[model samples]
Target chain A: MRNRKMAALTTVPYVIWMALFVVIPLVLIVVYAFTSKAGGFTLQNFSAMGDYAKVFARSLWLALAATVICLIIGYPVAYALSKMGPSFQRTAIMLLMLPMWINFLLRTYAWMSLLENTGLINTFFDNIGLFDLINKIALSLASDPSAYQPIDHFQMINTQGAVILGMVYNYLPFMIMPIYSVIVKIDRSMIEAAQDLGADSVTVFRKVIFPLSLPGVLSGITMVFVPSVSTFILSKLLGGGMNMLLGDLIELQFMGGAYNPYVGSAISLVMMIIVMICMTVMNRFGDGEDQAVML
Target chain B: MSEKLINLENIHKDYGGKVVLDNINLYVRDKEFVTLLGPSGCGKTTTLRIIGGFETPSAGVVYFDGKKINDLPPHKRPVNTVFQRYALFTHMNVYDNIAFGLRIAKVSENVIKDRVTNMLKLINLPDYAKREVSSLSGGEQQRIAIARALVNHPRVLLLDEPLGALDLKLRKEMQRELKSIQQQVGITFVYVTHDQEEALTMSDTIVVMNKGKIQQIGTPVDIYNEPKNAFVADFIGESNILDGVMHKDRLVSFCGKNFDCLDSGFEKDETVDVVVRPEDFEIVPIEDAQLVGTVKSTIFMGVHNEIMVETEDFTWKVHSIYNAEVGDKIGLFLTPDDIHIMHKS
Candidate 1:
């Protein structure tokens, strides 16, 4: 007990850092959301709920879409990784995380380059006689004189697909980490128990594995969904400002179009509330006594 | 009563570079209780798991009745195992855990209830039907495990140290309950345990194994009284094995003295271990005895006195009603029938 007290005293620096960096910032955000620059203490900041309503709806939907995509792509990969040997698991996860180590903007630019009209994909097709085939057949009526149109014909440079692609790529490891840890810790004997009870492979997965991995699913959803909602760079770089995503509008408020701290803080507060509500709903479904026991 | 229910033929198991079960073969007669008894890592559990279809033998075949079950999965087999930890589904209540097999068999809800109720009564746990298995006691969990296995009416029951985690008193109590349950079910039981006393008490036929090979398979009486070698003799019970040689019919020479033994098969001058139960030795007057010794020590047991006597060549242990103090001179007499002579294999 005395030693524990000494250890508690030793954590003073970390406790102060957490209060200053984390708690104070969150409290300040909530305080600033209601206080407006006009009356200084009016709910006028929330009065124009109409202006930010579209942003809230769009960002919430996009985050949900990205989380769903991550679930679809990440779950099977995590399950496959969990069944491998230790060396294979380590190397495979390292390779999956290799993209994250590169600069995030650089990787986003790489995707932009690939999807662009005059990018490597288009150049390869021109070199491979695709353009010649069109010209000879006179299907070239629609073809332009330029061999390649850089970001002119392809709309990928400023699209929602670009945002989703960026989100899935950036947040894939988050989806995998929780799910992989949970799946790997699943007892072999529980699956064996299901099998010995005459459940076939598909039935076993439906009855045992899926329901058992709900905690990881909920955690991964929170991890990917919360971050993707407010991401501005992906929409700015890939969407090319053509589709004004919620994140782009929020960035515009802080960076260029209007220096309205109150509106931006209100949007941020609403996003935080939506993420918390989703988390609470998830917790309600899988709280105290509902979890599947692997043992 | 079983008509050769399960048969295993020359099964081999290798893990990485080391072999765990080597060329194993055995058979389970219908309704007969057989125990695989051995020290740790002797491959008894491996053989049980193979029969349970949790493992495929590297070589040789496993047969259930007459059908080859070499490639069959565990769920496809007509066998159920009571694991050491019971391995009861903690997610379920007692009723659900028992009803799992029936549910998998796709029995109707009414039939599932009836079958689970019957099992609960059989295991003397009728009141525990709605209780979460995690809330049950160790002994209760054990009974629930037995009930779960029995509800399926499997052709054979595989028990891997079912009483291993219980306390001494509970373990002994469960041993009796398990034996009675086997008799009531009348199913072939293949039990695996390293506990010698559990094997001696519960098993009708015990297969003793060592170093991945079967040492001997025999009735408890045969295994105890007529052990095949030194390993079986030492493993089964108290064996006072003296290095001796058979000299002639019903006679052996040990401790630099010729004494009568209970062996007849060996030729004269064959090396053998002379085993005698402590109770078999009688202390007589030194004048008319075949062997004489001075009392080395005396231990007071409730029923009998354990006296150790030091002879000229060896120290002899005996359980006697007579009390003799240390340094007292006495004669040790053994009848030909009391001495058990086993060959050194």
Candidate 2:
């Protein structure tokens, strides 16, 4: 009884902190989403979201592509880390986390400098005469040298690919960490058992390792997908104001000439719902008490 | 003589400059059940792994069915292992787990189905085809592991402490079941364990090992009746080991008394280690016994009473059906055959 009383007393501060910081802001957002600028309740904010359908679709597509690319790259890296010696595993994990320690904006800006038309990547490509080879191919196809003028450098920045590159660079560690944690928790005996039962390396991975690591894969997908879908900073800097995501549109609503908190709140509410739905679906894959026990 | 199923010649294993197995040579005949018995870190598991093709010896040769198999990987070798922890695939059902190797072998669908069904029935889990491995009990999982390995039909099966996780009663039950299964399958089994009783209960031949070396290799009766050294005698069962002098052939002197023993060919008055089993000592009247002492403590084991008698030179353990209280003067008697003498090691 005394322990219970102490536990309840200790939780009072946290309850107050959450109510003031989290619950109040959420309540305010919901109220503003349903209220008009003139202080009257209305549903116009939701109806207005239809005007930005293209932005929403583009954001989802880019996020999906970035997520797929991260998984392709991160899974192999995580599996390799899981198989490395303990001393090397620790050092490699530390190196993976090193990029996350820098400020997010700084990392994206570094990508920007490297990806600009005359930047390091394009300069190296120009030095290798890759642009000249493409120009030569275009000339052969067009039958006119004047029609296919060779460029000095390739344009990589101010494009959808640049934004994706930024997101994959910044959020890849989040994907790898969870997957690596799950992979490392797998028992070594299972691998030996598979081999002893006549499974070759490829068969063991496909039949044993891949299936067992699905929960971590799901968690990584959700972590990278949700954040990339909602981000506006990378799109603004690397996308060069040409491509606007839902986050950029929401920010524009509250800060532009048409300063409307109601529409901003509505967009925020919709994004939060999408993230919640995503998490719910992913959680279903990792459900049941047995999965936790196995982990 | 039956054909040799597996032969390990001069196996030496080292990990990072530390020797785990040293100069080990062992042979398993066809359809024989051989057990490597030792305490932990005794390199029994290493020897078993070497035979299983999971661990290549630093310097040695392994022959499987008269073919050199040291260069073969575990997946290529015709051997299966039941791991100590049962290592069942958590993501798979019992049927799928048992069918894993068959699927890898690309067996026909109907044959895979028939084999898996038969394996489930053999393991006594006929209705557990769809049951996930996580839901099964330890014993059930163990049976599934055994079935999974046996379904592969390897010529030799290696088990590394497969019953080390079970409780006492369950372990005993599995030991009997395993022996019967070995006989029914008629395949060679190479079992490794630190439990001496389990080794003796299930093994046709027991290889006692310690400190990366084979201490003794014999049948259960021979191992128990005549251990090769002090370590073997003490490790197998309870013993009252004492320093003695071989007065002459067939005679030893200890505790200021000379007793006739069955061993001979020792130099006169040479120091030796003498082993007397607790059950070999018969309690008698103090005046008519070979040695008399006061009982220090008496423990009532279910089948026998264990009395610790402290004589002038050493404490002796005697097991008898009769109960004796603490502090009571007791006399112990031993025959010539009960005395086992060995050169001090």
Number of the predicted model whose DockQ against the real structure is largest? 2
DockQ of each: 0.45, 0.84
Compared with the true structure, what per-residue lDDT tens digits does model 2 show for residues B61-118? 8988888889898999888999999999998889899998898889988999999999
The deviation in Å at residue A220 for candidate 1 is 2.3
Residue by residue across B1-345, what tens digits does model 1's lDDT show?
A: 136788888989998868999888888898899999999999999999899888898899888888899999888888888887887876678898888888888899998999899888888888888998778999999999888888888888889888888899999988998899899878889999999999999998999999999999999999988888878987887667788988887888888888866568898899988887778787888887878889999999999999998888888888999989999999988888778888887
Report the TM-score of the second chain of model 1 against its true counterpart. 0.93
Interface RMSD for each candidate model? 1.6, 0.7
Q: lDDT tens digits, residues A1-295, model 1?
A: 9999999999999999999999998888788888878638757767766876766677777788999999999999988889899999999989988988899989999988987778776677777877667665554454764564332233455678888888898998889888888888877767776676777788777777876777787778878987888788887787776556666776776787787777777777776787678778877776746442221
Error of 1 at B326 (Å): 7.0
Off by over 4 Å in 1: A129-154, A242-250, A288-295, B279-333
- As a whole number from 0 to 100, the lDDT of residue A204 in candidate 2 is 85
